[model samples]
Target: MKYALGPILYYWPKKQVEEFYQLAKASNADVIYMGETVCSKRRMLRNGQWLDLAKEVAQTGKQVVLSTMALIESPSELRNMQALVDNGDFIVEANDFSAIDLAKQAKVPFVCGPSVNIYNGSALKLLVKQGMQRWVMPVELGRDWLIRLLDECSNLGIREQFEVEVFAFGHLPLAYSARCFTAQSEGRTKDECETCCIKYPQGRPIVSQEQQRLFRLNGIQTLSNDCYDLINDQASMGGLVDVLRLSPIGIDTIEHLEAFRQQNDKDRPFPTPDTVNGYWHKLAGIRQSEDEA
Candidate 1:
């Protein structure tokens, strides 16, 4: 399976974001997704900045895709999506339906983001009709369900026309809300509050009373505490998955990606407390069980 570097989900300094992508250009990745898919308030890199980065990365022979915000709460956000669709340089990953419309208007081939809630082959077919070239299955679905869906897609005759991508790594994006938790953490309301998420390079990790990591607080986004690791299943992944997405994290991401690239055994380096794949196995999302590594 091809490896894809997913859009950076955390808030990073402008220089740091630039440097990160520079380093990623040399990494063992085939596809690079650029753009701010999280909060609109986090503008470390604006449209021009992201496009410039995408241009630079594309030079390294990586297929670049511009990703839209998963939470588009304002008209301005819709306009931003329109701008990306109109750019006409790279493929657009439509995270929200508003972006899908924009892609349709632009007559551009688009990748369906995981947040779009495409569950069945019919919905997938509908999106394909709208010019979706690839679709990311939702995070909560598991192996058996995906096999069933793939079987259905085979029967439907349009399966060969679509690529299937999976969010194989990173903290799971559990939920999003109109309320901004980063602001709430600072004793401020979401509306009038200053953008405080800029301070936390990685979203604040919420820990249990016993100091066990529980969840991550990223503006309005809630993510699983454990880093979602799929290196163990890389070979098997090729059969069911077209691309494996490694979500951006603050610490040791390059190292993690390198390890994943070198690993061939499913149980090589055992995953640590900071990593888990319970959600992928259809078990409790936080369960930290593992096979012999």
Candidate 2:
């Protein structure tokens, strides 16, 4: 299956962001997604800069996709989404329904991001009619759900029309809110507060009262405390999954990408700790199934 490098969800410095993409250029990633899908205030790299980076990355023969914001709170955000849709060089990932509408109006083929609520075969068929070339399945859904959905799509004769991507690795993005949890944790309001999300590159982990890791707060996005891993499950995904997405979390992300690329080696070590494969096994998202363990 093809491997994709997902966009950086954290608010990183411009230099770090550029350096990370440079590493991606040399990695085994077949597809690369870029752009800020979280809060708009994290402008380390503006739309124009992201487009320029996309152009540069496209030269390496890897498919590049621009991702739209998951939550559009204002008209400015909507305008930005329009600009991404209008980008003629590369396809865009529609994270919100507004983005999908913009892409449809622009008559451009788009990929639906995981944030978009496309739960049924009917929704997938409708999106295909609107120029959706591919879709990243929502993280909460498991393998059984996907198999059934693909079967339904096959029966409807729309399964071959679009590709299927799964969020294979990284901390699961659980929810998004109007308020900036990162800023709130620092006793600052969302507006006046400086972009403090950069301080914690991977997000601030929130633990339960029993001292167990619960979730992570990254600006306005809430993510799972444990990284969701599916490298070992690749054998079962041969025919069902088109692409496996690995989200960029740190400098070591490229290493993990290499591991996923060379997953056939039985001696290769699994890199991240406290990983969860339960979501793929149809169990609680945070739990690691014994068989997978």
TM-score of 1: 0.93
Candidate 2 colliding pairs: none
Clashes of each: 0, 0
Task: List, residue by residue over 199-236, the lDDT tens digit for candidate 1.
Answer: 77667888889999888888888888777786776665
- Residue 117's C-alpha lDDT in candidate 1? 84
In model 1, which runs have C-alpha deviations exceeding 4 angstroms? 207-212, 265-273, 291-293
TM-score of each: 0.93, 0.97
Where does the lowest 10-residue lDDT sum fall in candidate 2? 264-273
Q: Write the per-residue lDDT of candidate 2 for residues 1-293, one digit (tens) a residue.
A: 89999999999999999999999998889999999999899888999999999999999999999999999999899989999999998999999999999999999999999998889999999999999999999999988999999999999899999999999999999999999999999999999769988998999998899999989999999999899999878877877899999999898988988888788455554554679889899999988876455
Worst 10 residues of 1 by lDDT: 284-293
Please state the error at residue 230 of candidate 2 in Å.
0.4
Off by over 4 Å in 2: 265-272, 291-293
lDDT of 1 at 156: 88
**Top candidate when judged by TM-score against the true structure:** 2
